[model samples]
Target: MTDAIKAIILGIIEGLTEFLPVSSTGHLVLAGDLLKFEGDTAVTFKIVIQLGAVLAVLLLYWKKYLHIGVNMLKMDFAKSKGLNAIHMFLAMIPALIVYLFFKDMIKTHLFGPEPVLIGLVAGAILMIFAARSRGTKTADTVDHLNYKQAFGIGLFQCLALWPGFSRSGSTISGGLLLGTSQKAAADFTFLISVPVMFGASLLDLYDSWDLLNSDALTLMLIGFVTSFVVALIEVVTFIKLIKRLRLEWFALYRFVIAALFYVIVIL
Candidate 1:
């Protein structure tokens, strides 16, 4: 496929799966194989395109995120909301460490098919167990989370770096297991993704260096715009939808996709 079509496909996958825990990177790996997209350009496309989806999550939660910024000036930053943002930053620590240390290996080796397929099946299996919990708590907003809980969730977020183990999926599941209401877990997961993804995209660009050119950069911009707009819609819808829905369907989807990929590629 041409670069434009590749960018569009990458953006759609990034938007849809970025928050779902189904692993957009994993799907993009599969898509790459199917489309016969080879070379580092394909890898760069996949990584840069995610900026779109992360932008979407940021836009949707802009009010909450912005509130923290405005409050920071008032010395009232410690008043609940700022604390939540602090927790998010805390949770980001481990993944940031991992990213700095192993990001190159991740880009070239981890995101490739073999390790990714293993991660997908492993994450799918874990989600099945996580789904069985059907966590029985609820929180309407971020204020309800405790420091310990935030730390725990942050540790879980680190799992997403493994390729098939999605950052949102693993972190949210970790929150649910710790008894945060599903919405809160999902919300925190979404909020946290923006910084983590932004950090990652920047890292990718730093490594991409002279490899990034006008055409690839343009496609990435297109992908980013597309993902950002769609992600905003999905986040708003996700907030409303989570109240009524169970994560079981997503768990099942992961399992089915894992099984299909395992058979096709690994087995």
Candidate 2:
């Protein structure tokens, strides 16, 4: 297949799975292996294209972000009620620290089909356990989450440093186990993900600047735009339906996808 075709396919997979409890990185790694699109350039392209999904989140939550920003500037904590900068910071620090410390080790050792398969199954098991054991949710909305809960979610997010452990899977399950409602957990997960993913993409792009010639830039742009459009639609629909959706359903999907990839590609 052509590079453009591969970009489009990967972009679609990233968009469709980025926000769901499914592992977008795992899918990309497996897809790249299948498409013979492995190597430094390919890895860089995958990470950079995630900016597309980040853009989608910004577009969807611009108002909330604006309110936080304005309130922060004015030093008006009371007015900046709900998911604020502090909450995001608390929810991001743990993963950021872990990623910074072990990123090189992780990239060298775990960015592969075998590690992704293990991560998928392990993440699935965590999701299943969270779904079964989560009881008496105390936070019904993002605004209701306490600092302790946000930090707890951040700790859970550290699991996503493992390639196939979905960030959303880890965070949302963490939120659930910590007493947040489904919609609340989903909202917090998506909100915190914007800065984290955007920063990671930019860092990866900076590191791979020399690799991004005209041809590679063209392919990355194609994937980027495709992922943005698809992710916007997915996020909007997901927000509407998240309250009704169950984590167990996504866990089942992770299990099925893991088995299929292991049988069809890894075997």
Candidate 3:
């Protein structure tokens, strides 16, 4: 496939899976395999393009992050908003440490063709359990949650390092278990993703700075634009669906998709 085609496909995959409890990286890897684009360069391209999806999260929640610093400069650190920002960073520290130490291992070992299958099945099973165990409780508001709960959710967020496990899924499940309402869990999941994804993107660039020339820069832009449009749409739709439906249905999707991949691709 041409770089343009790769850009479009990867962007759509990222947008669709970024919010759901399915790993977008897994889907992108499968897409790459199917499209016959399974080389080191292609793999790097997909990872780099994910910068676009993270950008969507940042764009959608720019005010929260912006105010995190603005409140500090104003010496209004006593504000709850500023405190939330502090909690957010504190929560991020665990993943940052893990990422810093094992970044290469995750990229080199975890996110490969073999592990994609493993992630698909394992994550699907976990989602099934999450759906069943989830109480009638709805975590619809982040304000109701405490700092320790957010940090707990962030710790669960670390499971995404395992390739197929959805970061959103893990965090939401953690939030739910920690007594966050469903919506609160989901909202906090999205909010927490901003730092995690951006940090990963920057970290990737930092590690691969040598390979990111003008060509790579241009391709990353294409991916960012594509993922932005798709993710915005995804965010709007996902919010609506979760508000009115059960996550068990998405688990069903994870099962069927994973089953199909097992039979047709992995096997």
Candidate 4:
């Protein structure tokens, strides 16, 4: 395939799986292997394309984020008004701590098919149990969650430090286990991902700065724009799916993908 086609295909995969419980990085790695896309530039492309999903979140919830920022400036840090900036920052602390300390270790040791397979299976099981065990009386929205619950979700997000663990999967499952409705859990999960993904992407870009040539930059732009448009659509659809309490389907998907990886790559 042409470079443009390759970029579009990878962008579609990123957009489709980024917010879902499936592992977007795992999928991208596997797809790149199959398609003969490799090296530092490809890695940087994958990381940068995630900006698409982050931008989708920003566009989708600009009003809420803007309000949170304005409130922060006025020192009106009340959860009752909406999701405040302080608590959102608090929710990000655990992942930040983990990343600061062990990011290089993880990248060196676990960014491979075997670890991804393990993470996929483990994350799938967690999602299944969380979905099945959800209580009827739960926090119904992101604004209803206390700082403790948000912190718990952040801790759970640490599970996603592994490539195939799926950050949204870990956080949403954590949310359900902590007595939040599916929609609420999913909402908070997406909201919290904004800063984490951005920081990681920036770091990756800085590390891979030498790999960007004209062709690679063009491929990155194609993937970036494609993922942005596709992620916008997928995020909306995912919200509707969460509202209907249908996250178990993603558990099944993770299981199937994990099994496929074991069969095709590890056998």
Candidate 5:
């Protein structure tokens, strides 16, 4: 296959796994390695193209964001309806601090299949625990989550710094454990993800600015657009899936994938 085709495939994998309890970074790492997309350029491609997934979130939640923006401008938090921008900002704090201090360490030492395997299993356990106790006592929706809960979710999001742990998985599982409904957890997860992903992508772009030559740029564009479209579809479908299916299904899927990759990496 052509480089562009490979990029498309990776983009699809990214979109499909980004928001689910399954890890986007883990899938991308495994798929990229399988496709021989290693080295600096491949890493840059993976990090930069995440903007596409962030765009999907922005597009999907534009109305809610706009409401928050307008209300903030008018100094009327109550009029923002159920979408509070401050809550999302607060939820991003812990991850931001963790990423800034340890991003290089993480990229150098832990951005591999081994750490990913451990993270996958650890995160899966959390998902299973949360799934077992879902629905008995939970906040009905995102609007019901207080600042403390949002901050608590942010702390949980720090686990996603460990690649396969997954941002959505960590936050959603945290929400479930904290008594938030699945849909609410998902909504909050998606909301907080927008800023964090965008910031991380920007940092990656700045760090890898010299790598953006013509051919590389073309591949990046293809990957970006492909991921955007695919993520748009997946983001919508995942919300529906959360409403219909148990999160343990995703956790179980992660377990199988992690075990498979564990053997592949070790052997």
Candidate 6:
């Protein structure tokens, strides 16, 4: 396949899986391996394309973000109810701290098929448990989330540092277990992901700036644009369907994917 074709394929995978309770990194790793796209540059490409998904979020939530920006400008934090900047910061802190400390070690040791398989299985179990044990929902909407719940969800997001453990999977499960409604949890997950994914993508792109020549930039841009369009569609569809979908359903899908990947790629 040509580089552009490979880029488009990977971009679709990233877009389709990025917001789901399925691991986009895990899918990219396996797809890249199969396509012979493995390298430092490929890794950077995967991270940077996540900005496409971030842009999709920005597009979808422009009104919310604009409201928050206006509130901040007016110094009227209290007026901007329902998932303001403070909640976003609280939801990001734990994962940010953990990533800063252990990112290199994680990239060195866990960025592999075996580790991703393990994370896939483990995250599935966690999702199953969260789905079954979620009881007596307290926070029915993002507006109802407190600082403690936000921080606790951030702690769960740290699980996603291990590749196949999906960020949406971990955070949504965390939110459910913490008594948030399903829609509320999923909404918050998408909301906080904007800042988290954007910052990470920018940082990775900065570190890999020298690797991007004209050809690489073209491929990356193709992947970026593809990811943006597909993710915009996926996220909008996901939000509509999230209320009816169970975490257990995603867990089952994860188990099937992990088994197939192990047999096809690892075994």
Local distance difference test, each candidate:
0.76, 0.88, 0.74, 0.84, 0.84, 0.87
For model 6, the stretches where C-alpha displacement exceeds 4 angstroms are none
State the lDDT of candidate 5 residue by residue for 228-264, as single tens digits: 9999998887778855578788889999998897777
TM-score of 1: 0.90
- Candidate 6 per-residue lDDT, tens place, 1-267, comes to 898999999999999999999899989888888899978788888888888888999999999878767777787767767767778788988887787778667767877788889999999999999988838898999888988899999999999989999999999999999999878888899888988888777767777789989988898899999999999999888777765599899999999999998999987
Model 2 quality (TM-score): 0.96
- lDDT by residue (tens digit), candidate 1, 1-267: 687887777777777777776788888887777777767877877888788887777766788887766665565746644245567777788888888898878887886777777777777766666767866664445677777778888888878888888877788678878778777777788777888888988988888878888987888888888777766777676666643466666667877887787778667
Q: Which pairs of residues have clashing backbones in candidate 3?
A: 138-181, 138-182, 139-181, 139-182, 139-183, 139-184, 140-183, 140-184
Q: Residue 73 error for model 1, in Å?
A: 3.4
Q: Candidate 3: where are CA atoms >4 Å away?
A: 74-83, 134-140
Query: What tens digits encode model 2's per-residue C-alpha lDDT throughout 1-267?
Result: 999999999999888889888889889998998999888889888887888999999999999889778877887765666777788888889987887778778777888899999999999999888888748988999999988999999999999988899999999899989999878888899899888888777777887798889999999999999999999999987866655678788888888989999998877
Give the candidate order by descending TM-score.
2, 6, 5, 4, 1, 3
Rate residue 252 of model 5 by lDDT: 90
What is the alpha-carbon lDDT of model 1 when measured against the actual structure?
0.76
lDDT by residue for model 4 over 131-186, one digit each (tens)? 88837635898888877788898899888988888998899888888888888888
> What's the distance in Å from true for residue 203, model 2?
1.2
User: Which should have the higher TM-score, number 2 or number 4?
Assistant: 2
Task: Write down the RMSD of all candidates, one decimal each.
Answer: 2.3, 1.3, 2.4, 1.8, 1.8, 1.4
Candidate with more favorable, higher lDDT: 1 or 2:
2
Clashing pairs in 1: 52-228
Off by over 4 Å in 2: none
Q: Which consecutive 10 residues in model 1 have the weakest lDDT in total?
A: 75-84
lDDT of model 4 at position 131: 82
